[model samples]
Target: MTDTATDRSTDPQKAPSTPPQGGQGVMARIRSYTPTLRVQRVLAMLLLIAQGGITVTGSIVRVTGSGLGCNTWPNCHDGSLVPVAGAAPMIQQIIEFGNRLLTFVVAAAALLVFIAMVKAGRRAELKTLAFVSGIGVIVQAVIGGMSVLLDLQWWAVAIHFLPSMILVWIAAILYTRIAQPDDGTATRQFPDLIRILAFVAAVCLAAVLVTGTMVTGSGPHSGDAGVGMEGRLEVDTRIMTYIHAAAMYIYLGFTLVVAFLLHRVKAGDAAKRTAWVLLAMIVVQWAIGLTQFYLGVPRWTVPAHIAMSSVVVAFSAFLYAHGRVREGGTGTSPTGSPVGDARLAASRA
Candidate 1:
């Protein structure tokens, strides 16, 4: 006879068998774990911070002339994932190897945010951004390895920095995107003038960054002291610096004009606020650049300047994003209603 409810507990057959290792049960359990939007928001923030932060650490390695500390790619030293006991100065090895290790921290953070986005069934937009961020970390790692293999060539170093700026831009986009209500649609808040100026500002910012890297390539700091200045860009440091400064001045002018337009159109407070923040960042970054120059580009200023560059890029991206469709309105609307009442519920988290 079949077991009755009363007999179920007493019957060995009624007991669940041990789940198969790495079977459906395990996957089901994993799938059942969903993260709250608040938790996801925090994780997104961490990913954003890490993407920018790692650049600072990279600058540290460069400024300290430890770019080739391990002297190998995909390894700290031959056949080792970390610094070897007697290979090179311990300080150089430690700094270079430690910076490499940070890639894992960034990867882990991005993975967490990606998994959370998927588990929560977030919109495709959010998932796509998270996915790009996850992949960006891998791409950055590969480029870093390439930099090591290329002997820290100035152009290679510049290439490495470019991708990171792109990744930081992407991360900033993800941060703002995720800040919206979990299930809400999105729409634009600014008028056409604001959007157009924002685009111009972004273009100017890109120019500024590109020229800034060129200025770096011609400067004394060649990533590693031993890398030598043989392959450094042939451009005069003074000329490149002046060009970079000019580009920055133009960028500042565009940003200020955009800020004025943001107010002229009477855009949302969020848009206005972002404009002001971008302006502030621009001023601060400009000051840092000038100070670092006259003060003779101290090693300490390298990290600070690099860090501010990341901030400037992030905010430039942010201002551009604010001009686009915002957190909530028509989720599928490409050109969302500018005056739509929909707004992100991100403040809840």
Candidate 2:
């Protein structure tokens, strides 16, 4: 009690510590630095692109018969983490291993954007989207390994591909949400009727994707040249193609209806623009599908077709998300009134 506290304050070893000039700690620094809207949007966009790009690379591994190039999961071969001489063809090993490596890249991008969202104190919806997207990358990696372990069976391969589309959709929505402020009220940009129509269109797109995968499963490419037609789906390729094409037409019809309604309504510019871009993507995909059907599904068209699939999914998600948006205005309540005004009124009541 005799000035002990004062002595402790003066003694460096006994004194309470102060944070460094920059920040208290690494996490504190990260939490203190809020990312700009532009930076956050860019990170979201990168995640979206990575989600889409990885699918195309996976297609490359399939079309080149390199699906089994590694011949194992979590490792290049039985013992090596990388390519080894006389293990597999150099090109196949490189293609398969490289595709696996890209999974990490996609995961890393998702993690960065997610961390940015958390640091920026984004809304729960945005954070959830980022979390799901990051988780999806890990799930996809596991599925990919399963496909290899199962000798690249048609169903396993199809399973691996479908989740990528879902991740793309999630990333697209995240990109849209990152532009909004955390405290803003959610507003509908279009009528509920139109939103319902968009939902139906999205469902049709999913059907198209599933049927298309079935077509590939039944077609010439069985991922591994050595597997040949043994593990392929037993369905006739022509029948599967017909089913896939029919699903595409239905999807196209529903999308056209959504586009028409979007134009009729005074939807936001972003919504209308996304609708048009989606239409264009659907048409391009149609052309590619036709080319693949007539040309016996060439190797080159597979990647193009897969890439366009990602684009279509992204734009479709963008259009749907435009139906409802966070107003990004100050102190707005869910009813579109100022939060302060509402609070004052409540106080008066």
Give the top-scoring candidate (TM-score).
Answer: 2
For residues 1-349, what per-residue lDDT tens digits would candidate 2 score against the true structure?
A: 5598998888999898777665357766554555656778888899999999999999999999999899998988998999898887989999999999999999999999888767665667877999999899999999999999999999999999999999999999989877765667789999999999899999999999999999999999888899999888999899889999999999999989888888887778888889999999999999999999999999999999999999999999999999888776764332222432343354345
Alpha-carbon TM-score of each model against the true structure: 0.86, 0.87
Q: Any runs in candidate 1 off by more than 4 Å, and if so which?
A: 1-30, 326-349
Q: lDDT of model 2 at residue 130?
A: 94
How accurate locally is residue 225 in candidate 1, as Cα lDDT from 0 to 100? 77
Residue pairs with backbone atoms closer than 3 Å in model 2 (clashes): none
Clashing residue pairs found in predicted model 1:
185-328, 185-329, 186-328, 186-329
Q: Candidate 2 at residue 297, lDDT?
A: 96
RMSD of each: 6.0, 6.3
**Residue runs of model 2 more than 4 Å from their true location after superposition:** 1-31, 331-349
User: What lDDT is obtained when candidate 1 is compared to the true structure?
Assistant: 0.82
Q: Candidate 2: what lDDT?
A: 0.88
What tens digits encode model 1's per-residue C-alpha lDDT throughout 1-349? 7658757677788865675476786886665555654677789889989999999999999898899898888988789888988887899999998999999999999999988777666677888998998898999899899989889888889988888888899889887776565445457778777778778878888899899889888888887878779678998888888899999999899889989988887888887898899899889999998987898788888898889988988988888888665355445421122221122222122
